[model samples]
Structure formats: C-alpha cells, structure tokens
Target: MRSRGTYYLVYPLVIFLLLVLLFPFFVMISTSLKPVKEVYANPPHWIPQTIHLTNFSDIWGKYPLGSYFKNSFIVAVGTTIINMLLCIPAAYAIARLRFVGKNFMMYLFLIVQMFSPLIVVISLFKVISRLGLLDNLLALILTNGVFTLAFAIWLLSGYFRGIPKEIEEAALIDGCSRFQTITRILLPIAMPGVVTTVIYTFISAWNEFMFALTFITSMEKRPLTLGLYNFIGRWAVQWQYLMAAAFLALIPVVILFMLIERELVQGLAGGAVKG
Candidate 1:
C-alpha cells in the first residue's frame, strides 16, 4: 500500500499534468466541432449543441489544402530522410569512433542551437538568395534538414553511446565493413534512437512556421501554417473556418506522434536520464 504522503504528493501532480496538457486538446476538439455561436458563447461551451463533421470536409474543399499538404509533406519527409541518413552515421562515429576534434565538433553543433533563430536569419537569407533557393520547397527541406541535423546527431550520439560496443565488435569480427557494421549491426540495436531522430526531424519540419512563412512567398507553396492565414480575412475573421483549419492542420502531426509515441517516450526518457 502507498503511504498517505506519497499519494498526496503524486495525486496533485497527476491532476496538474492532465489539466495543463489534456485540457487544451479537449478544448481544441470541442472548438473544432462546435459552431461559431456555441464556440464563442458568453459562458463558453465545452460541448457543442451539434457536432460538425463537415469542418474537415469544408477546409479540405474550401482551401488550397492539397498544395499545403504537398509542401508540408515534401519538407517533412525530405528532412526526415536527410537527418536519418546523416545523423545515424554521424552518431555512430561520435559514439564509437576516435578522432581529432570529435567532441569539439559536437559542441559546435549544440552551440548553434543555443542561439535564437533570429541570429541566423540575415546570413541564411543571403545564402539562400545567392543559391536561388528562397521561396522553394527544397529550401524548406534543406533548411529544416540542416537545422535539425545537429540535434539529431547529438541525441542519437547519446543513445548510441549508451549501447555497448561489444555488439559492433562482434559484427566486425564476422567480416562486416564499417558501413555494414552500422547498417546491419548498430542500426538494429539502436532502432529506438533512429526512430526518435526520424520523428523529431519530421515534426520539427512539419510544425516549423516562422521559416516557412518567411521563405515561402507563393500562396501555392505555403504549408499549413501559412495556408491557415487565408481563413482570417483582414476586416472580418472566419472563426469557425479558422478552428476547422487548425484542427485539420493538427491531424497529421497527431497521427505522426501517435505512431512513434513509444520511441518519443524512450527518447525523452533517455535524454532526461542521461543528458
């Protein structure tokens, strides 16, 4: 049996977590379904007079949604592919390889993240302009890829370091090449880390708003974040449509999170415990 003090301590934390996190999601769903009338009712309505399934249909049909989805998918998927391809090997190298300046290089990458995004805007814009990558999907892809690559390498490096070297040594003795050692041996063992890196890169690319807003100039090239701006007209706002758009925009990310939730948990715990 739990002690009274332990129960008292844990119960309130549980309540706090649920209220802070789950409550907003509940409100989001409620707002997504509720009509504007009930959504903004004087007292506020937790549940609507009538549930609206058509919101999803409406946004998809009404907005330039296909283009938004395409743009987001391109960036998200491209970033995921690049981060995993580079970071997995980079992580393995940092974790297992002995070389000059390895720690220094890792430190540099972490330091880059410490600065605010605003700091890099001028240089990145100049470079992007010179390369003619501004307002391009590939630009978003490359931006997200480069931005998240450092963290992926760092996180996966930690997870990789936590794994025993005996596994790779065994595979090496079995005549595996360095690449083979990574692909056939280390990767299977560190699948959790790779999965974590993939989800993190994908979600970061997907949810990225500021860079997307700035880099993407065309209406057709806009991701969901920019696409959402269309619903809020200058003079009058379409509250219902905005809510619907927000809900729809949230769906893919929610699904992605659900699929990799286990890895996310493992990744979070790994970082918290070791980092």
Candidate 2:
C-alpha cells in the first residue's frame, strides 16, 4: 500500500520534470510558427491563430545560412578526425605500453581538461594571426581538436584498458602484427567509445561560439551562431525569424542523437563501469 502510494507520488514529479525541460522547446516551435504580430500578442498566445511558415524561407533567403552550416560542418568533422587520429594512437599506447611518465601523462591530460579555451584565447589568437589562419575554418578545427583531445584520450584509454589483454596476445601469437592487432582487433572492440568520442567532439565543435566568433572574421566563414546575428539589429530583433532558424539548426543534432541513441547510452554506461 505504501509502495503504491510512493509510485503515485513519483509519477507526478517525473511528469512535472519532463514538462519543465520541454517547455522551452515548445515555446521555440510556437514562436517560430507564429506571425510577427501574434508573437507578442497581448495575454501571450501559446498557439498562434494564423501560422506563418515563411519565416524559414525568409531566414534562408535573407542570410547566408548555407555557408554558415557548411563552415560548422567542416570544422566539426575536421576536428573529430584530427582528434581521433591523435587520441586513438595515444590511448592505445597508454593502455598497452609501459613508457616512463605514463601515469604523469594521464594526470596531465586530466588536468588539461580542467582548463577552458577562454583562458588561452588571446595567446591562441596571436599564434593564429602569425600563421595567417585567423579567419580560417582550419583555425577552429585545430583549436577544437586540441581541446577535445584530452577527453578523448582519457575516455578511450579507459575503454581500451577494459578490453581483455589476452585477445591482443592471442592475435599476436597467431602471426598478426601489432598494428594489425590494433586495427583488426582492438578498434572493433572499442567502437562504442569511438562513437561516443566522435559525437561529443563533433557536437562541441558545432556549438562552439567563442573561438568561432573570435577567430573567424569573414561573413562567409561564420558558423550558425554568427549567422543568427542577421536576425538582430541595433534597434530591433526579428524574433520569428530567429526562432525559425534556431529550430532548423537543431535538426542535425537531433538526428545524430536519434540515430545513435542506443550506442551513446551504452557507451556512457560502459565507460562509467569500466572507469
């Protein structure tokens, strides 16, 4: 009887939490579909009487949204690729090899994760200016890759260590070279961690604003965050168009999560247990 009562109480709490979390998304969609006049309607209409679907078209035609999306995609994918190339090898070595300062290297990576890019942005700006990469997508790619690498190394190292060493030894004894063993054996086993790392790094790169805003100067090179600036002016803001563009921007991330929902869950759970 008491357990049943507790379940009844818990249900309302869970429902309330879900509503709280979802309320902003509902508002964004509602505002996006509302005509400009209906957006600030007196008494605040939760639902618009007349839907305006042209906001999407207006934002796309009025702004360089396509270029912004392309820049963001290029930076995110480039950053993920570079991070994987660097972190995976380092993670494998950390997990399998017995080099001096191995423990120190692990500690250093962990410590590096504690620092935010904001702290070093000025120094980075100077170096990027010197390299003539100040307004380039490569600048964002390099910076994002550097920051995301520590997390990848830490996460992949834990996952790699969780794999049974005997499997690698068996493959080696059967005439497989060390590189072959890593490529053919370990990488397949550690795929979940790889997916998690890639998704996380990609998302981080995608949503990056400070570095993108600071390093990128050309209008054509701006990412989605900067692209949204078109909807705001010194005098007034275009709320409807901004909301529509924001909603559209969410599609890629939502699709990524939906497709890899299962792997993401399992990878996080496995990392928790393994670590």
Candidate 3:
C-alpha cells in the first residue's frame, strides 16, 4: 500500500511533462487559426476570436503544395523500399552467414553511421549533377537510401540474430531451401524489426531538408519541407500561412503513427534483445 501510494507522486510530474511537450503544438495550431491582426495582438490569445479556415484553402491554391506533397511521398516511399530490399539481405548474411571479415564488415556499417549527409553534401551534389539527377526526386530517393542503409542493417541484424537457429535448422531438415526458410519462417517472426525500419526510413526521407533544398532546383520538384519556404519572402514572413501548412504537413505522419503504433512499440522492444 505504501509503495502504491508513493507512485501517485510521479503522476503530477508526468502530466506536467506532457503539457510542456504539447504546448508548442498547441501554439502552432492556435496561430494557424488566428487572423493576421490577432496574430500580433497584445497578450496573445490561446483561442482565436475568429478562426481563419481560408488559410488551408488559400495555401493549397496559392502554392504548389500538392506537387511538393507528391514529391515527398515519392522520395519517402522509394527510400523505404530500397532500404528494405538492400538491408534485408545484408542483415541476414551478417547475422546467419559465417565468413571471414564478418566482424569487420559489421564495424564498417557502424563507421558509416558516424558520417552525416551534411558532411558530404558538396561531393554528393557533384555526383548527382554528373548523373543528371539534380532537380529529380530520384536524387533524393537514392541519397536517402544510401544514408539510411547503415542504420537499417545494424538494426535488422540485431533482430535477425535474436531468432533461434534451431528454427532455421528445423526448416532446413524439413527440406526447405534457404530462401524458403527465410521467407516463410523467419520474416513473419522478424516483422517487428521490419516495421521499425520502415518507419525510420520513411520519416527520415520525408523530413530531409538539406539535400532536398540543395539538389532540387525546380519549384515543382521540392518536398513539403521546402514548400514551407513559399510563405517566406526576403522582407516578410507569412506566419499564419506557414503555421497552417506546417500543421497540415504533420497529418500524414500522425496517421502513419496511428496505423503502426502497436507494431512500432513491439519492434523496438523485441529489437533490443540479442540472441
């Protein structure tokens, strides 16, 4: 009873932290709905006297937001797919296959993670220019895939290693080929890890701003992150419209979380353990 009573003391702190984290989102939504005049009014209002619903419609029609959204979706999906195809085989090989320099190869993947995209932006830009991929969504897709590959392999390999070898041996003894053993038996069990990887890759590619800004020259090729620039000029900032677009931009990510929220939690937990 005493231990249970002590737990009540932590509830207030948790609630306080939740409110603190949520406050900025609340402010953004509030600003998005406020009229331009009310935005800078003295003693800013948390709730607007008049909500401006036109912000959404205006921004949509005025800017190439739809194109930006399409480009982001294309790049994000492409990055996730390429990462999965490449990482799955590499992770499986590292976790299950025994060969010389296997440990060295694992170390190499970890080393790659230490290098951020920002560090090689100039070199990458030159390469993309040579490939004639500048201003193309393909450029973002390819670059994101390469940047995210190291983490995907490291994560998936850990999950792959956690599965019992006896299960694979049983499948093999039952006349299943190596491919069949992996596809039918191992994949279903390792789905949590896969989901985790998908979410990470998708989000990273979607939110990537530096490469998108640098590589994309055409207005229509820009992603949602770059689309926010439409509301800013050299002299003025359209705070309301900017916030409105930003709020709308968050919807897809929120829906994604809602859809796979369960699998993500399970994957993270399961991926933590080593076989």
Error of 3 at 158 (Å): 1.2
lDDT of 2 by residue, 1-275 (tens): 56888998998999999999999888999999998899878888988789899988887787788888888899999999999999999999999999999999998987897789999999999999999999999999999999988978887887898899999999999999999999999999989878878887888788888998899888899988777764574367878888888898888887776765665465446546433
C-alpha TM-scores of all predictions: 0.85, 0.89, 0.86
Task: Tell how far residue 101 is off in model 2, in angstroms.
Answer: 0.8
- Of 1 and 3, the candidate ahead on lDDT is 3
Runs in model 3 with CA error above 4 Å? 1-16, 254-275
For each of the candidates, the C-alpha root-mean-square deviation to the true structure, in angstroms, is 3.1, 2.8, 3.3
Q: Best candidate, TM-score-wise?
A: 2
**Candidate 2: stretches off by over 4 Å:** 255-275
Better of 1 and 2 by lDDT: 2
lDDT (tens digit, per residue) of candidate 3 on 19-126: 999998998899899888998889889998999888878878877888888889999999999999999999999999999999999889878866888989999999
| lDDT at 5, model 3 | 71
Q: Rate the local accuracy (lDDT) of all candidates.
A: 0.81, 0.86, 0.86
Worst 10 residues of 3 by lDDT: 266-275
For model 1, how big is the CA root-mean-square deviation? 3.1
